[model samples]
Target: MFSKACEYGIRAAIYIGQQSAELGRRVGLRDVAAEIDSPEAFTAKVLQQLVRAGLLTSVKGPTGGFELTAQQLATVTLRQIVVAIDGGDMLQGCALGLPQCSAQQPCPLHYQFLPIRDQLNEVLRTHTIGELAGKVHDGLGFLKQFT
Candidate 1:
């Protein structure tokens, strides 16, 4: 599963993508956090990581904030966000915390979970935040109808 930071990071990325697609311009963090319901402080920290990882662009001063760079818009996959916040090891490491657990020496859940894990990782690696936004923008199915 994803951590709160990872969840927030994804939400932040999605919000930025939606704004960029909707307004055709860069977006600010205070606005993004407010739109996504993430804490401004926590979202700021995640935004810093995203900027450092080259997944986002940040400007300073009165008009400064954050936006995804062109290269980032093209290539910044969800895996990068997950690694930036939670580390890639969370995906590849032993699920049971077995020090030496691996494909050869399986954990209890390895057989059942490894395939699912591999599929999930592939999804993260293959999809960009922009690609993900298309899914979110499609509307939240029945969930949106309620609110």
Candidate 2:
């Protein structure tokens, strides 16, 4: 359960990575938003965060937008994007959203949820954006509508 910003950031990064990896195409904010089915303005803000995090590069004026380097496309993982946008706190926070939840003072579901969080972190850590994009590029994945 990522924040809305984090959700958009993951989708936008994978989509941008796919465009770069598949066609060497640079993506505009509007096109990225439409492709990911996110709000243009909010997506713009989320993209700026990714740019600041060094997960993406951007330029202004004509022919300027956002893109990932070839190396980044192949290596940046979902955990990196989520942490950059959502912070490390996201991985450690209470699944039940309880302020005092922890191992010492566990929430109703804290013990049950901890393993799920750990598994999620491992999965996110291992899955590269390129892998997810590869799925879309190879017709094995769907970002929004199948295409």
Q: Largest lDDT belongs to which candidate?
A: 2
Please give, for residues 33-141, the per-residue lDDT of candidate 1 as tens digits. 8877888999899889888887878888786777776556678899989998899877887778787787799889888878887888999999898777667777741
> What ranges in model 2 sit over 4 Å off?
none
Over 4 Å off in model 1, which ranges? 138-146
Q: How well does each candidate superpose onto the true structure, as a TM-score?
A: 0.88, 0.90
> For each candidate, how many residue pairs have backbone atoms clashing (under 3 Å)?
0, 0
At residue 4, candidate 1 shows an lDDT of 87
TM-score (C-alpha) between model 1 and the true structure: 0.88
List the lowest-lDDT window of 10 residues for candidate 1. 138-147
Clashing residue pairs in candidate 2 (N, C-alpha, C atoms within 3 angstroms): none
- The Cα local distance difference test for each model comes to 0.79, 0.89
